[model samples]
Target chain A: MKRIRMIALVAAGTVVASALSACSGGSEDGGKDGSDGPVTVSVMEFQQSRIDAVAKLIPGFEADMKKQGKDIKVKLVADPLTDDQFKTKVTQQLIAKQAPDLIDIGDSLVPGWAGAGYLAPLDDYLKGWDGWDHYYPHIKKAMVRQDGKIYALVHDTGVQNLFYRKDQLTQFGIDTAQPATWDDLISRLEQIKQKTGGTPIVIPAGTAWGGSTWTEGFQPILGGTDKNYYSLETGKWDLKSPGFRAVFDLYHTMYSKGLLPVQDLENPNPWEPTKYVKFPEGKIQVSAQGTSGWKFDWGPQGKAPIKGLNEKVDTWQYPGLRSGDAPFGWSGLGFGYGIPASSPNKDAAMLLAQYLSTGKPLADQLVSSGAASPRDDLADVKPYADEPKLLQAGKDLATSVYVPTGDGAEQVAQAVAAATELIINGKADGAQAYDAFLKNATDLLGPTLVKE
Target chain B: MTTIAATASAAAGPTGQASPKRRRRRTWPVVLLLLGPAALLIVVFILAPAVYGAYLSLTNTQLTGFAARDPQFVGVDNYTYLLSNSEFLASLGRTGEFVLYSAIIGQTVLGMTAAVLLARPWVRGKGLVGAAILMPMVVPEVVASLAWASVLSNNSAGTLNRLTGLFGADATDWLQVVPLASVVVVNIWRGIAFAMIMFQAALEDVPGELIEAARMDGATALQIFRFVTLPLIRGPVFLYLLLTTISTIGAFGLVYFLTQGGPGGRTTISAIYIYERALQFSQIGIGSAASMILLALVLVLGLVYVRLAKVEV
Candidate 1:
C-alpha cells in the first residue's frame, strides 16, 4: 500500500508539472524575438486583395532600398474587420502600444487619431516627394495637422450624388435634369410621393452607413453658409448660426414630409437590399448613394437591372433654388494610408505608401480598381474618363466646395441621429425636433449662432 | 533475548491492526493527499488571480507607451465614475429586467410545465421528449443566437415575419422596434432547456408512494402535487433557480448577436457595457470596477438564495 501511494503521488506530480511547464513555454516562445525580426506591415482586410498588386511593385522598391543597404524584409498582415470591430481592434492596439506598422485610416477617424498622438508626422517624407505637388489642396489640407505635420497620404477619394429613376421621375412629371437647389430636389421627391404609393426615397438610418444621408444630404446646405457649420478658420462653434439651424430644419422637414421611408430609420438590416434593389425594380423610386452604387445597386439587380440600367437610371446634382445659381454639394476625400508610430519598418512602409499613390500604380491599380486617385496628374485617367457616371462623380469630388470643420463632428452626428429618431417616431414635430437638435448641438459644441 | 524479541514482534499481528489510535493517526496523511490537487489549483488559478484582480480594481492602469508608467491607486474612484454614468445605470436596469423576465419567469415556468408533462408515464416516448427538450441546451450559444436571429429578423423575408405575412399581417422589425422583447424571447428559448433538464432530474427523485398516498387521502392531483411532490423537489428547484439567475446575469452572446444594444441603448445589458468600455473605449479601470461590482452582486444574491431556500444536499 505504501509503494502504491508513492507511485500515485509521483504520477499526479508529473501531471501538474507538465501543465505548469506548458504555460511557461507558451509565454517564453511568444516573447522570444523581442521585436527583432523582419518588419511586418498591417493593412486593413478590405485592402487584402490590393496587397498582391502592391507586392508586384516591391522589387523596384526593394532595389531602391537595397541601394541604401537596409537589408530589411517586408511582410504584410491583413486585418479584415468590419467598421466597428476594426475601430475597436485598432484602438485597443494603439492603447496597448502594439499598433500595426501600417494602418489604413479612414478619413472620418484621421483627425481623432492625429489628435490622440497615435500617428506619425509624414512631413519629412512629403517634402522630398514630388507627388505632394500633384495632390488636391483640399485633400492635402484634410491629411495635415494643425501642428504643420502631414500624418497620412490620401489613397482614394469618392463622390456622393442623388441617384434617381429616370422613368419614375418622368411619370411624376418632374424634370430628370440635374437639380439646381435643395427645394428643387424636394419638389421632385414630393411629386413622386404624390403620384406613386411606393416610398419615394430610401435612406439607410439604422446603421452608421445610413448616417451617410446627412453627409451627402445636409452638408451641402450647411457648407453654403459664410462661416460654414464649424469654422476651423475661426476655431469656434457656430451652433446658433443660420447655416447650422437651416440644415437641421431641412433634415426635419424631409423626414416629416413623408418623403423617405420612416420604417427604414430603425431598420435593423445593415444592408437593406429592399431599399436599393427595390428602387431599381420599380418598387422604390429614388436614393442618394455613393459612386459604388453603380456596381453595388444599379448594375445587375439594381434599379434598372432588367438589361438597360445604364440608359434608364439617371444621376443628377441637387438643383439650385433659383436659375443659374446651382448649390454645389460638399465633397470630402475618403480614406488613406498612414504609417503607425509603432511600425518597425517605417522606411519600407513609407515606400509602399508612396508607390501606391504615384505614377502608373496610382492611375492603373488604384483608380482602375474603382477608386479615384488623389493626384491631379491622373485627373484624366482612362477608366474614370470613359465611364460617364464615374466621370461625373470624379468631377463632383474635384470641384465641389466643403463645409468648414465642425466642432465635435461626431457629437453633431449623434444629435442628428437622435433628432431623426424623434421625427420618425412622431414623438416631436419637425420644428420641435429641430429646436431640440439645435439645443443639443449648442450644448455640446458651445453657442455661436448662424442662420439661413 | 532473541526469543523475547520474536514474541514481541509476533504480538503486533499487522502494522495497521496494531492499534485503533495508530490507524486513525494514519488517516490524516490520506486526507491531505486527497486534498492536495484541489488546494494547489485553488492557490494557483483561483485565489492568486482573485487577489491580483482586486489589486487591479483599485488602480487606474492603461496599457501603452512608457514601460514604467506607474498605475495610480484610485481607491474607489472607478466605481464612483461607473455608478454616476447614465449609460452604466441604464445597462444595470436592463440586465435586472432581463434576469427577472427571461430567467426567472419564462424559463422556470416553461421548464416546470414541460417537466411535469414529461414525468407522466402515460406520455408516450418520454425518453424521446426529454432528449428533444434538452437539444437546445446542447447547442453552442452562438449557433443558437444565430438561429434565433434569423427566425426573428426584422426584415420582411425573415422566418417569423414571412410566416406572419401568410396571415395577412404587416411585417414587424422584431429586433429594432422591440429590442428588449427580442432579447428576452431568445434568452428564454435558449435557457428553457437547461431548466427543463434540471427539473426533470429533480422530479424523477421524488417518491411516487408519497404522492400516491396523498392522493389516496382524498387529495386532488393538484393538491397532492402542491403538498407532497413540491416539498420533496424544493432543493433542486432552488438550485436550478440560482444557476439560471447567475447565468442570465452574465449572458452575452445571445443579446450581442441579436440586438447589439441598439435602436438606442434599449437592449444594452451590463455585460455588453463592460465589453464596450473595456474593449471599445479602452477604459480598463472602469471596466474592472464594473466587473467587481457584478461579482459582488452575484455573490450576495447567491448567499441570500442559500439562506432563504435552506437547500439540503
Candidate 2:
C-alpha cells in the first residue's frame, strides 16, 4: 500500500510539473529580453526570400540611421500565413492589441482594417515623401479610404491576361491577335475545343482564392468601365448594373456551350500548372492566367515538366463583351506594407515602411529580385523594362482601372463568389444568378446601392 | 438485555470514543495535502477555460478588430442562427455519417479481425504483424494526410489513377468526387491501429483454458470466438467504441489538409465547419455556439457510454 501511494504521488507530481512547465515556458522566453533593450519590430513578411534580401540590406539602413543619430536597431521577421490565415491572425492580433509593428495587408483588407482603426493614417508620411507622386493615380486611389486618408503603399501589382498556346490557336484556325470582344474569344474557344477535342478555357472555381479568376479575369470585360464591380464615384455596388449582368450572362453562355473546362471547375485541386501542363503537352488549348506565368511557370526558369512551353505561348488583353470599346481590366496595388496604429514606435515604424516602399534599397531589391516596382521612378529599372512580357504586363497595370476599396467591398466580393458558385454548379441560370447577386449586394451596401 | 449491554458498553466506550474522533480529524489534513495541487490545476486550467468559453459563447464575443470594440450581450442569437444555418446542419450530418462508417464499422471490424488473428496460437510473427499494422498511428497526421492526398490527386500522375489506368479504367478525381470517403479512409487508417492494439491486449487477457475446454466440446473456432472470446474482451471493446467515436467526431487535421471540405462541402465535418465559420469568416459568435452544441452532444454520448457500456473493474 505504501509503495502504491508513493508511485501515485510521483505520477501526480510529474503531471503538476508538466503543467507548470508549459505555463512558464511562454513567459520565460518573453522576459529574457530585459527592459530598455532594442525596439523589437515584428513583421509578417509574405515573401520569405524578399525578407532575407531585406535582412541583408538592413545593416546599411542601420548604419545610415546611426549616422543620423538614431540608436534604433532593426529586426526583420517573416511568418507567412495563407490568405485566410493571414486575415484571421492579423485581425485577432489587432483586436488583442498584440499586432506587429509592420504587416503586409492585402488591398482587399485595407478598407476593413482602416475602418476598424487598425491601420495608421499614412497621409502625413505621403505628403512629405516625393515618391507619392510617382505612384500611378489608380494605384494611389486604391490605397485611399472613404475618409480620404492613405493607409498603405502599393508594393507590386499584377496584370491578368488570356494565355493561349499559339500553335493550338493556329491549328484551330483561331486568330492569335487580340480578341475584339468577349464573343470573339468564346467563339475561338469553341473552335479550339471542337478541333482538338480538348478543354478550351480553364478557370479556377474550386476554392475561394481560385474563385477570384471570375472576379479579376472576366468581370472587367463584362462591366465595361474601369470601375467594374464597385463604383467609387457613386459609392455603390455594381452587381445590379447592366454591365455586371451582361458579364454573368456571357460567362453562363460560355459554360453552357462547353467553351470552358467544366470538369476541372468542380474538381478540388486548383487548376494551375495542372491545367497548363496539359496545354503545353497539346491536350488543352487556352487558359486565363497572370502574366508572371510567362517567366516563372513556362519559360526556361521552369523545369522539364513545363519546359519550353512559353516558346509557343502568347497573351492578349481579356476581351470586352461590350462592342466598340476595349475591355477595361481591373487592377489594384496588390499587397503593401502598413504600420499598425498601436505600435509603440510609430515614427520609426513609418520610417521602416517608407524604407520598404519608396527608398532606393527597395527599388534595388526589386530590380535584383526580378519583381516589378510600384514607383514610376523605378519603372526604367532594367529587369522589369528588359523583360518583354513583364514590360507589357507592367504597362497594362499602369493603364488599368483599380477595384474600389471602401464600405461594401468585402460583402460584394462574397456575393460575387456565391453567384459564381451557383453558375458553376448549374444551380441558377445566368440571369437569376446575376439578380441574386445584385440583391445580396443591395442588402450589403444598403444606401450605397446606385440608382439606375 | 439493555441493562447488560449498557454495562458492557460503559466499560468500553470511555476508552476509545474521543480518540477515534480525534484521529479522523487529523487524517483530513493529509487528504487535502495529497489532492490539493491536482484539484488546483484542474480548477485553474480545464474548468476555468471551459467556464470562460461558455460565458463568451453567451455573448457576441468576436476575436478581432471593430467586432471586439463593443461586444454586446447577444444572448442565444448565435446559437439560433447556427441551428438554422444549412451549412452547419450539413456538416453535422457528414460528421455523424463519418463517425458511423469509419469509427464504428471500420475500427470494430478491422480491430476484431486483428485481435482474433493475434489470439490464435498457430499464427506466425504475430508481434511483427501487430507492429506493422500499428505503424500508421505513429505517423504524423499531416504526413499521413499528404500521403493520402498524393494517392488521391486528380492528375493522371497520381498513384491510384496510374494503377487504375493499367487496368484500362479511366482516371477519376477521387478526392473531389468522393471526398467524404477519402477522408473516412484516411481517418480509419490512422485510427484502426489504436483499436487493434487495445483489442489485442484484451484478447491476450482471455484465459486459454476456457478456449481449450470449448474446443474439447466440439465447438468450432467461430463459435468459440462468438461465445467465449468476445465476452471476455467486452470491456476493451466498449472502451474502444467510446474512444473511437469521440476521436472521429473531433477529426480535423486529415480532412483539413487533404480536402479542405471542398467539392461543395462534401467532406466538411462539424469541426471543419466550426473552423471555417470562426477563423475563415470571422464569425466567432456562431462558431462558439456551434462548439457548445458539439460539447453538449459529446457529453450526452459520454454519459450514455458510461451508463450502458462501462465495465467496472
Candidate 3:
C-alpha cells in the first residue's frame, strides 16, 4: 500500500512537470545556439504573396550558408490575421518567449516593439555589416531607434504618389502637372467632379480602414503643414497645434463639398472599392496611393488591371497646404524583418534579414510587389531601370517625411483616425473634429501626456 | 488508498478498538490524499491565473513600451480609467443589447418555436426540419462567419443583396447600415441550435397527460402552454437561459470574425472591447480591470438566475 501511494505521488508529479514543460515550449532555449546542427528559423509573415516573396529569397540565404558549411532552414509562419491581430499575435508570442526568430513588421512598429525589449538591437550586427551604409539616408535614419541604436533593417521603401488619370485630366483640360497647393489639388478635383459627375478624389478615412485612416488619410495632409503630431523636443503629442486643425479642415472641406468618397469609407474593407474597382474603372479620377499600387492594384497581375498604365496614369508629388510650401505626405518608410531577442538563432536570423534587404532579392521584390528598393543606388538596379514611374517615386523619396515612430505613436494614430472619422461622417467641421481629436488623445494618453 | 490501512493497522497492534481521535486523524489524511491531485490541478491551472489577473488589474502593465518592461502598481487607477472610458462603457451597453436581443429574445423565441413545432405529432418532415435547425451547430464559427460575410457583404454581388434586388430594393451595405442588428442576427443564427437542443430534451419529459388535463379544463392553447408546458420545463428553461446569457456575453470569435466591432463602433461588445484594450491597444491593466467588471456582472447574473428562478444547479 505504501509503495503504491509513493508511486502515485511520483506519477502525479511527473504529469504536472510534463504539462508545464509542454507549456514552456523550450523558453529556456532563449539563447540556445543551434549553429552546429540543422537549424530552422521561423519568420512571422502575414500575407501569402509576401510569404512567397520571402520563399523566393530563402534559397539564397540557405545556399550562401551551405557555401560556408552551415545548415539553416527557413520556416514561414503564415498569419492572415487582421492588422491589429498581427500586432497582438507578435506581442503575445514575444511575451510568452515563443517568438519566431524573425518578425516581418512595418517600419513604424519597430520602435515600440523594440522598446519593450521584444526585439534584439541590431546595432552590434550593423557594426560589421558592409551593406549598412548602402540604404538611402531616410531609410538609414528610420532604422535607428530613438535611443540611438539600430532595431531593424529597411527592406524596400516607397512613397505615396498623388496619382491621376492623365487621359481624364487631358479631356477635362485641367493642368496635369503637380498641384502647387491644396487649393490647386481641390480645384482640379472639383473640375474632375464637375465633368465626371462623380467623386474624383479619395483619401482613406474612418476606423474600418484601421491605421490607414490616419496614416494615409489624415497624416498625409498634416505632413503638408510641416508639423507632426509627436514633438521630439518636448516629447509630447501636439494636440492644440494648428497642423492638427489644418488636416481636419482639409478633410472637412473635401468631404463637405462632396469631393471625397464618404459612403465607400463605411464599407467593411474601405480600400477595396476605392482603390481596386472605382479607380481602375475610371469612376474616380484622382487619389493618393502607395507606389506599390503599381504592381499590386493596376499592373497586369493586379486585381483590377488598368490598361496602358504607363501612359494613362501620371503621379504628382504630394503638394503643400499653401502654394510654394514644400511637398510632404506620409511616405519614405519601408517594412522589413527584425530579430527577437529571445530567438535561439540570432546570427542566422540576421543573415536572413540582410539577405532579404540587399542585392537580387531586393530587386525582385520591386518587380514582384513594387516594393521599391531603399538603396541609394536604386537607379542602377535593373528593375528600377526598367520602370520609369518606380524610378521617379524612388527619387522623390529623398524629399518625403517618414512619420516619427515611438511608444505613443499608435495611440496618436488612433486619435487622428477618430478625428477624421468625425469629419467623414459630417458630424463635425474642422474645429469640431479637432476638439474631438484633442479629447480622444487626452483620453487615450492621459492629461499630462497631450500638450499644445 | 483507504487511510493507508497498513499504517493504521500497525499502529492498532495492541488495541482491539481504534480510538475515535486516531480514526478521525486517519480519515482526514486519506480524504486530503484523495482530493490532492484534483486540487493541485485547479490551483495550478485556474485559480492561480485568476488571482494573477486580479493582481494585474491594479497595475499599469501594458503589452508593449515602458509599461511592459517595468509595470508600476497603480491601485484602482486602471478601474477608474475603464470606468471613464467612453468606448468601454458603450461596449458594456452594447453587450447588454446583444444579450437582450440576441440571446434572451431572439434565440429563446426562435428555438422554442422550432421545438414546439417539432414536438407536435402531426408535424411533417420532422427529420428534415430537425436537421436544418441543427446544421448551424456543426458549422465552424469561422466558416459560418465567412459564409455570412459573403452573404451580408456590400455590393450587388452579395447573396442577400442579390436576393433583395429582385424586389427592386437597392443594394445596401448590410453590415454597415445595420451593424448591431446584423451581428445580433448572425449570433442568433449560430446560437439557436443550442437552445433548440436543450428545449427538445426538456419538452420530451413534459408529461403529455398534464397538458391534456389542462386542455380538458377548457384552457386555451396559450393557457395550456403558459400554465402546463412552461412550468414543467422551467428547470431546463432557467438552465438554458443562464448558459446562453453567459455564453453570449463572453462571445468574441463569431462576431469578431464577422464584423470586428466596426462601422463606427456600433457592434463593439464587451468581449471585443476587452480584446481591443488588452491586446490591440496594449492596455493590459485597463483590460484586466474591465474583465473583472465583466466577471462581476456575470456572477451577479448567475446568482440572480439561480436564486430568482430557484434553479437546481
Candidate 4:
C-alpha cells in the first residue's frame, strides 16, 4: 500500500511538472536584439493582401541593407483577423510587451495606439528621408497625433465619393449632375426611388461593419457642419453639438423616407451585396463608397465582373451640408508602417519603414496590392497612369477629409455607428438615440473626458 | 469483472472485508495513472485561467496604456459598473430567454416526441429517420451556420424565401425580421439529435413488460408517455437538460457568425456581450467582471441541477 501510494504521488508530480513546463516553454525572449550578428526584426502587417505584396519586397530590403554593409533579417507577421479582432490582438501584444518591431495600422487606429504609448514617433526619421516632401500635405497631416508627433509613415490614402448608376439615372430622365448640398442629395435619392421603384441608397450602418458607418456614412456630414465633434484646442468630445444631430437627422430622413435599403444594411456583410450586386443590377441607384470600390470592388479585375461598369457608374463628391462650403467626405489613411515603442530594433525598423514608403518599391507594392499611394508624384508612375480610377482617386484626395487623430476617436466612431444603427433599425429616433449614445459614451469615458 | 470479483469475495465471508483493502491497493496506481493527466490538464487550462480571470476582474486592466503593463486594482468597481450598465444586464436577461426557448423547451419537446415516435416497433424507415434527424448535429457548426444562412437569407436567392414566394408571400429577410427566432430554430435543429439519443437510450432500458401492463390496464398512449416512460427516464432527462442548458448559455460562434449581435443588438446574448467587451472593446476589466458574473450564474444553475438529480434518485 505504501509503495503504491509513493508511485501515485510520483505520477501526479510528473504530470504537474510537465504541464507547467509546457506553458513556460512556449514563451520567447523576443524583445530588443541590439547586438549585430543577425538582427531579427519582426513586422506585423494589418491586412493579408498588403502583407503578401510586402513579403515580396523583403528580399529587396535585405539586399539594400547588404549594400549599406548591414545584415538585417526581416520577419513579417500578417494580421489574420478583421479590423476589430486586429485591434484586440495588438492590444494583447502591447500589454504583454511582446509587440512586433513594426506595425501596419490605419489612421483611425493610430490615435488610439499612439495615445496608449504603443507607437514610436517617426517625425525625426521621416525628416531624414528625401521622399517625405513628395507626400500630399493632407495625407501627411493625417498621421500626426494630438501631441504634435507623427507616429506612422503614410502609405496609401482612400478617397470616398457618392457612386451612382449613371445609366439608370439617364434612363429615368433624372438629372445626373452632382448634388450641391444634403437637401439636394436627398431630393436626388427621392427621385431615384420614384423612378427606379426600388431602394435608392445604401450605407454601411450595422454593428458588423464596425466603424465604417461612422467613417463612410456619418463623417462627411459632420465634416461639412459648422461645428465638428472633436475639438483639438479644448481636447473634448462634442457629440452633442449641432453637427452630430445633423448627421443623425440625415440617417433618420433616409430611413423614414424609405430611401435606403434597411434589410440589406442589416446583413452580416452590409456593403457587399448593396455595392456589388444591387448597385450593378441597377437596384440600388447610389452608394457612398471608397476608391477601392472603383479599383478592387467593381473594377475590371474585381470579384464581381460588371462589364462597362466605369461607364455605367459616375463618381461624385459627398454633397456638402449647405451650398457654401466645399464638399466633404472621409478619406481612409489606408495602411502605414510604424515602430512600436517596445521594439528593440527601433532604428532598423524605422529604416525599413522609410524605404518601403517611397520610390519604385512602394509604388510597386501599391500596384500589386491594389492600393493608391498618398504621394502626389506617384500619379505619372506606370500602373497609376494605366488605371484611370487611380488617377481619379488622386484628384479626389485634394478635398477628402481624414478623421482627425485624438485619444478617444476610435471609441467616438464606434459610438456614432451604434447610435446611427439604433435609429436605422427603428429602435430609437434620432434625438433619443443621440441622448442614449451620449450617456453611454460618458459612462465609458467619464463625463469630464467628454464635453456636453 | 468488478461484479464477478465482488460476488466471489462475498462467498469468502472472513476474507471479504480484507478484499476491499487489497483491491484498493492494487487499483490505486492504475487509477492515479489514468486520472493524473486529466486532473493536470484541468488545473492548468481551466482552473488557472479562471482564477487569473477573477483576479483580472478586480483591476482596471486595459489592452493598452499603463494599465496594460501595470494594472491598478480597483476592488469591486468593475462589478458595480456592470450592475448599473443597462446593456450588460439586458444581455444577461436575453441569454436566459435564449437558453430557455432554444434548449430547454424547443430541443426537449421535439427530441422527446421524435424519440417516442421512433421507439414504436411499428414505425417505418427508422434507420432513415434517425440518420436524417442526427445529420445536423454531426455537421460542423460553421457549415451548419453557412447552410442555414444560405437557406434563410432575405435575398431573392434564399431557398426559404424562394419557396415562400411561390405562395405569393413577399420574400422577407427572415434573419432581419426575426433574428432571435431564426437562431433559436437553428439551435433547436442542431441540438435535437443529442436529446433524442439520450431519451432513446433511456426508453429502451425501460421494461417492455411494464409498458404492456400499463396498456392492458386501459392506460392511453399519452398516459404511458406521461406517467410511465417519463418517470423511467427522469435521470436522463435531468442529464440532458443540464448538458443542453450549459451549452446553449455558452454558445457564441454560431450566433456570432449569423447576427454578430446585430440588427440593433436584438441577438446580443451574454456570451456575445462578454466577447465584445473583453476582446473587441479591449476593456479587460469589464470583460472579466462580466465573465465572473456568468460563471456564478452557471454555477448556481449546476447546483440546482445536482439538487434536482438527488431528488429524482
Task: Choose the strongest candidate by lDDT.
Answer: 3
- List DockQ for all candidates: 0.18, 0.26, 0.47, 0.40
Which digits, one per residue and each the tens of the lDDT, describe model 2 over residues A345-396? 6666666677666656665545433345666766565445556665566677
By TM-score rank, best first, the candidates go: 3, 4, 2, 1
TM-score of 2: 0.84
Q: Residue A296 of model 2: what lDDT?
A: 36
Clashing pairs in 4: A32-A344
lDDT per residue, candidate 3, B1-313, as tens digits? 5436666776566774889687556555455556767887798888888799899999988887655788889899988878887778999999999999999999999999899889999999999999998998899999999999999978899999999999999998898889899989998998899999999999999988998888889999889888889988888888899999999999999888877787767788999989877887788888899999999999999998988679977
Q: What does each candidate score in C-alpha RMSD?
A: 7.2, 6.3, 3.6, 4.1
User: CAPRI verdict on model 1?
Assistant: incorrect
Worst 10 residues of 3 chain A by lDDT: A27-36
Best by DockQ: 3
Clashing pairs in 3: none
- Fnat per candidate, as a fraction, reads 0.09, 0.24, 0.49, 0.49
lDDT of 4 at A323: 41
Question: Which tens-of-lDDT digit does each residue in A243-274 have in candidate 4?
Answer: 77666777888888899888778777776678
Candidate 3: tens digits of C-alpha lDDT, residues A64-102: 989988778778787766566688888889888888898
TM-score against truth, every candidate = 0.78, 0.84, 0.92, 0.88
